[model samples]
Every structure is written in C-alpha cells, then in structure tokens.
Target chain A: MVGAGHAGLAMSRCLAVRGIDHVVLERGEVANSWRTERWDSLRLLTPNWQSRLPGFGYEGDDPDGFRDMTQTVAFLQRYAEVISAPVETRTTVTSIRRDDEDYLVTTDRGEWRARSVVLASGACNLANVPKVADALPDGIASVHSFDYRNPDQLPAGGVLVVGASATGTQLGYEIHKSGRPVTLAVGEHIRVPRTYRGRDLMWWMDNAGVHDERWDEMDDINRARRVPSFQLTGTDDGSTLDLNAVTDIGVALVGRFAGLVDGKAQFSGSLLNQCALSDLKMNRLLNSFDEWAAEVGADADVEPSHRLDSTRVPEKPPLTLKLAEAGIGTVLWCTGYRPDLSWLEVDVLDRKGRICHEGGVTSSPGLYLMGMQFLRRRKSALIDGAADDADDLSEHLAAYLDG
Target chain B: MSEATVNNGVNADALVAAREALTEAPQAAQFNWRASCEWKNGTHSHSTVEGFFGLGEEQKRSKTFAFDADHPEIFASEDLGATPVEYVLVGLASCLTAGVAAIAQYRDIQLKSVKATIEGDMDIQGILGIDDEVRNGFDGIKVTYEIDADAGRDDIEALVAQSQKRSAVYDIVTNPTAVTVEVK
Candidate 1:
C-alpha cells in the first residue's frame, strides 16, 4: 500500500484482519499531510465522533467537537500504534509499474515487489490553480490553499480569494478577521448548514443515510464525484459558515473569476443565478430531510424544521476589479485540489488524469485506488469513510490473488 | 405514465433513440453548421444557409434559407433588416424555446403557448472608439419567458432553468469561445 494517511492505515488494518501482509510506504511520518499541508487554524470538517478507522474509532472526550490539526495528527499516530501497521516512514515511492506478473514499487529508500498494489496516497495532493494565474502582475503574491499557513504570510493589502468552497470561505473569513479586506470569487458551490433542527448536520445526514448513497446508484457518478465541498467550517461553537456568514462579516462577494483581462481582473455577471441555484439546492435538501423526519416519526424529537435564508446577492455586482486601485496585493487560490499520481506508471488514467475505476477496482486487474471522492459511497472522502472502502477493496484484492 | 409515443407535438421516443444512438456513436454527433454572407452595401449584408456537415457526411436542407441583416438609420446605415446583434438574440430565444419544448415533452407536460422577451444592454462608446475602457459587446443580457403550460409555477420555472442549462446558444453567449480570422 502507498501512503500512511488514514486511508492507507485503514487498508493496512483490513489487510491484517484478512491475514494478508502489506507494508504502508510513507514519504514522511504517519499523517504527513495533516502535519504539514493544513493551515494553523484548520480543523476536521467532520465531527470527532466521525473519525473511525477499520478497527479503531475516536475515543476522545470531545466527540461532538472537531479535531484541530494537532489533535488530528495525534489521533492518527495513536491509530497507527494501536493497529501495529507495518508503516515504513520517510520512504517515498518514486514510481510504480507492472513487472510481469508482479508489481514493483521504487522508492527513495529501496524497492519492493508485490502481487497487488493499493494506491491510498490521497486526493488532495496538489492545488489546482488555473492557467490565468500566470497572467497576474509579478508584484502580487499568489498563494494556494495548500501552502497557506496564516493571514500574516500575505502582504498588507486586500486579498482576492478565487474559490468559495470550504477552503475559500474559511480562509476568507480568517483573513477578513485578521484586518485584511477580502474579495471572494463565488462559483458553483454546495451551501450546507453546520447544524439543523438542534442537531449537527452530520447527525442528520448520518441518520438520513445520505452518506451511504452508493456510487453505482447515482444517475451520474462522475457529476456526483465532482460536486464541490460544502461551504462549511468546523468551529468550537458549531456556528454555521456560509456565504451569508462571510458577507455579514464584510467580505465582498463577487461572481466567478473569469480571467485577468488587460491588467484588470474580470468577473462573471452570474452571481445572482449562482446564488439562486445554491439556494434552491439547499432548500431541496432540507425539504428531503423534513420529509424523512416526518416519515420516520422523528420530527417530534428534534426541533421544528426551518429553512435557511436565501443567499443575499448584490443588485449590481461589479464585473471587474482593478487590483492596483483596490489595493489588492494577494490572490489566494482555494480552487480545490487534484490527485498527484504522476509517479504511477500505469495505463489506467483517463484523459483528465482521473483513474479509470469502478468503485475502488481499477481497470488493471491487481491495482486499486482508495480515498477518492465518492469512490464507493458519498462519504468516501471523509475521515470516517475509509473503513468500508478499505474492506471492499481489500476483499477484491484478496479475491484477485486467490483467483 | 403515458403510452403515447408523441407528447406536445414532439416524438419523444424518437428523440430518446437519437440521443442514445449519438451517445454510442459520438463521432456522428460532431455537426458543423455553415452560413455564407455577402456584403450588399454599407452595413447591409445577405446570408444564405442551405448545406451543413453532419452524420459523417455533407447534408443539404430541403430548401435554401436566406436572411438579410443591416444597421438602423440611427447608426448611419440602411434599415433594411434586423441588426446582427438582434440576430444573436433571436438565436438565443429560438434555441431556448426549442429546448423548453423538448424537455417539457419528455416530462409529459402539455404546452399551450410560449413567449420569450430578450433584451441586451450595450454601451456604444466602445464600438465608436470613444472609450477604451468600455466593451464592444452587450454588458448584460436578460431573457424572460412566459409559458402557458399544464404545470405549476415551480415546474414552469424549473423548465425555463433547465432549458437555459441545456441550450447551445445560451452556452455560447454566456461563455467564451475561440475564433480565428485571417486573410486568404
């Protein structure tokens, strides 16, 4: 197995339970990304109780609270110890290729040959910055969410955040709180409340079985996998974090970032439509939850169901922003991430660099991918979702070996 | 469910079959529409459309189609026909209207009448070369649809939204496209 993150560690536990031997290769220590990639104030989007592995689950006192970066790293470290996973730390795999009937993994430390390979490296390895970023003026400091640590790292000026998913909304709120004006570029996003009807949204989704929606059951699995993360944040108070929250705190919301045109940043004029679409979808989801609650006779147990206010859109949003005139110095790209699988010398990748897979099974007979968004279920990318996927994939791998 | 093969004057079964066929043979779905225009006078021109390429071969219309385009007298040209920008509005309206009909038929909704009003706002300063900051095209375009259909208000609104979502001309007008121009 490649990587030593939650996915890899969970797969290791599964393999062990199945009496199969495997070594998890990690470039750094266990949970290397949680130790390095996340910002100082970042926390797990899901609640602590949702942090479950194959055989291990969160045993902390604050199950309702979120795990900050430090806590998350410690939790993973404890899981690694408890599972006794054969993790080879500080060994980065340079390439993986088919060697006749076996697979060979070459790393900086050494090499290993196995009959089957599980790619659990993760999905958010590289920030997907657009090509128009190169057109920006050299004086502006551009930072992807991957490399961003805090607001102090940015120069003293207004900032333009180029995506309004979870990362963008969180960082925009943080930087705005740090006394730097922020302009958030909004696009297609999923607006979900952190809590609903006196319970956490995760609790509602868990009870309603939204997370367990199978990939094959979806009408368009590709579209389902490409849906943006919810505009949410994990906070101690469990406060809802959405566009309205950020706007109430004085963050200027603009349309989608079109391009840098003639020294000025161009924005789309579809802000109203985008907000309407998001509002419509949010209401639809809440309605489904309400119907479920009524049908299951759980409405009397929870608070009265209510819908969130529609996103407030400006009557006439500005379509262009002169960076110099607006004193905007930094462009923070929270535009999402893509899996970095350049080292995989396999022929299973599609034209868009996505692995050709049905659920966790790859086109290649003995290869499997883990930890992708909606790999087998809707929650496949979440911390708690690894166990089920690992079990299914490990079963497939074992069966392939047996056959 | 209705057993009829046609709904709202559209052969829904044939449409679905064509969609499935194109999905199987995507190369045949690559259609190229063509039109030829000749300058008639200052700011006035005539265009003809009789042939296109589709289904992996050249195709011809049953009859030759023609159109005349000219600027208004206020723009210092003959008011012979609709302006080019007006033609663009027509394209958007027709495309969206067709999409609404097709989708409504698919959803088993009977339509009585459909009317669309399109307006594009433009600042002439850019086209006149009076201001470099202004843009030559419309700053914004708004389309309003009034449909008398056997559906609720929400259902009608959803139909219009879905039409805009699937309309080819709507996508063309809202997004950027690459075009090349050179002397032969």
Candidate 2:
C-alpha cells in the first residue's frame, strides 16, 4: 500500500484477512487526507450511518447526523486500530519503478522490493488551481480550498470564490456569513438536497442502489467519471446550498471563470443555464426519492416547491470585477483536485495521465490501483464502498500471487 | 392601506418613535401582553394574542392577532399552522432576527439580508409520558445566523451577542421566571 488513507487501510485489512503480509506506508499519519486536507468546519457529506468499513460501523448516538472533521478523524484512527493495519507512518515513497517481474519501491525511509504495489493514495493530493490564479495582482491573495481553514485567515475584504462545487458553495456561504461579500463562480455541478422525503438523501440513494452501478453499465463511463460533485452541505443545521439559497445570502452568482483580462476577473454568461441544469437534476432526484418512499409506504410531508426567482440575478452575467476596486482581497479557488503520480515512472498512465486500469487491475503485471474514482462501482470512491473494492482487488491479488 | 416604500426592511420612523417613547418615559413600556386560547381537541387549540400599549389613554388599546397550533401528521393531531414547539422556534428566530434588524438600524448600517435556522431537539418520550426522566421542554436549542450587512465579523458577533442579551424571549428561556396558575 502506497498511502494509509481509508482505502489503504481497507486494502491492508483485506490482505491481512487473506493471510497476506503487507506493509501500508504513509507519508504522514494514518488517514492523512482526512487530517490535512479537510477544513475546520468540514463534515462528512454522507450521514453517519453510511460511515461503515469492513467490520465496523458508526457506533455513535446520532446516526442520522453527519460527523464533523474531529469526529471523522477519530473514527478513522479507531478503524486503523480495530483492523490492526500495519501502517508505517511518515514513510514517504520517493519513487516506484518496474524491476523484472517485481516492483522496486524507493522511499525516504528505505527501499522495499515487493511482488505487488497498491496505490491507495486516492485523489485530492494536488489541488487543480487554474493558471488564472497566477495572473492575479500581488494585492490579491490566492489560496486553494484545501489550504483554506477559516475566514479569519483571509484579509478583511470581499472574496471571489471560484468553482461552485460543494467546497466552493460551502466556502462562499461561510465567508458570506462572516460579513464579507462573496462572488461564486458557477460551474457544472450536480445539485441534491441534504434531506428529502423526511430521510437523508444518502439513505435514499443507498436504498435506490445508486451505489451498485458498474463501470460497464454507464453509457459514457469517462463522462461519468468526471461528473461534478454534489452541491450540498453538511454544516450548521445541514441544508442544501443551491444557487437560490446562495443568492438569498447575497452571494453574487456568476458564470464559469474565463480568466483575468487586464487585471479584471472575467466570467462567462452561463449561470442561469447552470442553475437550470442543477434544478433539473434535483427535481429528478427528488422524484426518484418520492417514488422510493411511495414504494416503501413511507409518509413524508415535505413542502411543495416554491421556485427560486432567477430574476434576482441577471440573465446574461458575464460580468467582471476589478480585483482592487471590488475590495476582493482574496480569491479562494475551491476548484476540483487531481491525483499526483510524478513519483511513479511507469507506462500505465493514459492520455489523461490517469492510471490505466480496469476495475482495480492495471496493465502492469505487479501493479494494481485501488480506491480510484469509479474503479468498479459507483460508490468505489466513498468510505461505504471501500470494503467491496478492497475485497475485489484482494481476490485479484491472491490469484496473481498463486500464479 | 396605501403603498409606502420601506427602507432597510424596517419602518425607521416608527422604530424611532417607539425608541424615543421608551427612552423618554420608561413607564410607557410597561404594557401587559395577553394571549387567550381554548382547546378544541387533542393537541389542537386556537389563540388570539393582543398587543397593547400604555403610552396614553388613546394608546391604551389592543391589536388582535390570531393563529392556530397543532401537531404534525406524524403525531396524532390534524396538520394545523404549526406545533407549539415549532412556534417556539419561530419566536426565537424572529425575535433574534428582528433584534438584528433593530440593532443594525441603531448602528446605522445598511442591512442587506438576514437569514436564520433554528433547531431544537426534543424527546417525545416525555410528552408521550413514556419516560419520567426526560423533560417536556426542549433538551437544547441551537440557532445559526447568516447575516449580511455593511460591517465586519466582529461587529456582527457583537450584534448577535447584544441582541440575545436584550431579547425578551431569549431572556425568558435563559433565565428563571415566575409563573402562577389559577382557574379564572
């Protein structure tokens, strides 16, 4: 195991149960992603009940409630203990190269010759900050969402939070609540309510078997792999951060960030269409929930829809705000992230630089990828699906070892 | 009623008049508000709360406001306006939000918007008489405010702190109050 996150821990447990000897190496402490990448007020997007590993589930009082950063970190640490994952903390891998039929893994601690290597780092190592961030003047401080902790870290001025994903919308909401004006640059995103039909949406999705979707079943697997994150929040009372709510809180909604033109942040005019698309997806999901509820004879009294007034925002919103005049002292880029594999000098990467793998098996003989987005199933990347992915990959590894 | 433009989402002149009356004569603020209600059935009741003033003989009158309360469909009552506990949440939210508005006006800050989400956890076991240990009142209440104004975060925090300090309902919940019951 290359990294000791949830994925790595799950793989370690599965391998251990199968009577395999493996060492889970981590650059930092166990579950370093949850510890270092999460914000101060961050919470698990899924409900507590869905926080299940192979042999353990959430044993807390509030199963329906979401776990905040502290609780989630503690839970991961407990999981590492219960599973007894032999993780060598602070052992950073410097490189991975193919040597004959085996793999040579060189690390800061020492080099290890292994029959197989599992890259369980998962995504979110390198933040995908756009080049436009570099063009901003020295007066404006630019920080990625991963690096952002709170509003106090930012200078006292307006904020232009780009990328209206879960992180972007959340940061926009948090900064706005702190009495700073915010402008959210809208992007393609799936919008789902936090709760629907008197049950958490995670429960509905789980019951609906959305997680069981396989790679082959997808009409366009590549497109599905790049689907935008959901526009939902697990913070403060846990509500949806739809465009309407964001606008209601005085967050200036704009289109995709085109780039800086003459020191002015330029935006495209696609906000209304983006909002419409999100509403469409939300309506479909709500309808699915309603159908499931009716099938289960579940009685839920949700209010009828009162459509958001899009007229509150302009129809063509390709506007620009002068960086200095707009009092925008900071521009926190809540854009998405990509995995960093610069250390792995291998031929398995595709044109998009992603690891070339089917399910969890890579093209290389002794190399396997686990915990990848859409590796085999729809929920493969989530904690709830980590066990299944690990088990499947372990089956492949056992066969390879036997051969 | 005539159409009138409202400024800062508040009637500034009316607020000034009320503030001036309270500041000039503290006794003018000693008006007893009353709520009379009759139960129609289980968990269903009608109430009419009268807002009265004691500023002068002409102001010694009442403005009637009526509403209904009933349990939700999940409970055993007809779905009416809202449950009593929901009403309590509504009161706390509005009182605090109104307090924000008033304080913003006092501070001469241009109010953009104010939003609040008030949540409380209650044990139905107490109301259902299943557990004697649990209290009928809420176990605890949490209020989250998302206020946007022409002020910094510290100012807003101070504003919320001051508002809660001076809020009547907030005081009622946070402090002990004397209540006597008698058949009249």
The residue-by-residue lDDT of candidate 2 on B30-149, one tens digit each, is 766667888988888999876555664324335678879988888766887688889889998899889888877766666688899999988989988999978788766788888887
Question: CA lDDT of each candidate?
Answer: 0.90, 0.80
Q: Which CAPRI quality tier does the interface of model 2 achieve?
A: incorrect
Interface RMSD of 2: 22.1
Q: Compared with the true structure, what per-residue lDDT tens digits does model 1 show for residues A61-163?
A: 8899998999999999999999999999999999999999889999999999989999999999999999988888878888999999999999999999999
C-alpha lDDT of residue A325 in model 2 = 88
> In candidate 2, how many Å is residue A388 off?
1.1
- What residue pairs are clashing in model 2? none
Which predicted model would earn the best TM-score? Answer: 1
Lowest-sum lDDT 10-residue window in model 2 chain B: B1-10
lDDT (10s digit) by residue, model 2, range A1-403: 9998778888888899999999999999988888888889888888888967878889988988888878888898999999889999999999999998889999999999899999998778899999878899988999999799999999999999998888998889999999889988886677787766555678877887788788878865766878886877874465666777888888888877866866798775445545655665566566666676677766445444333333245554545678888899999999988888989987998756888788878899868887777878888888887888889888899889888
Q: Native-contact recovery for every candidate?
A: 0.00, 0.00
Output the number of the DockQ-best candidate: 1
As for candidate 1, its clashing pairs are none
Q: Name model 2 segments beyond 4 Å from true.
A: A236-238, A295-313, A316-318, B1-184
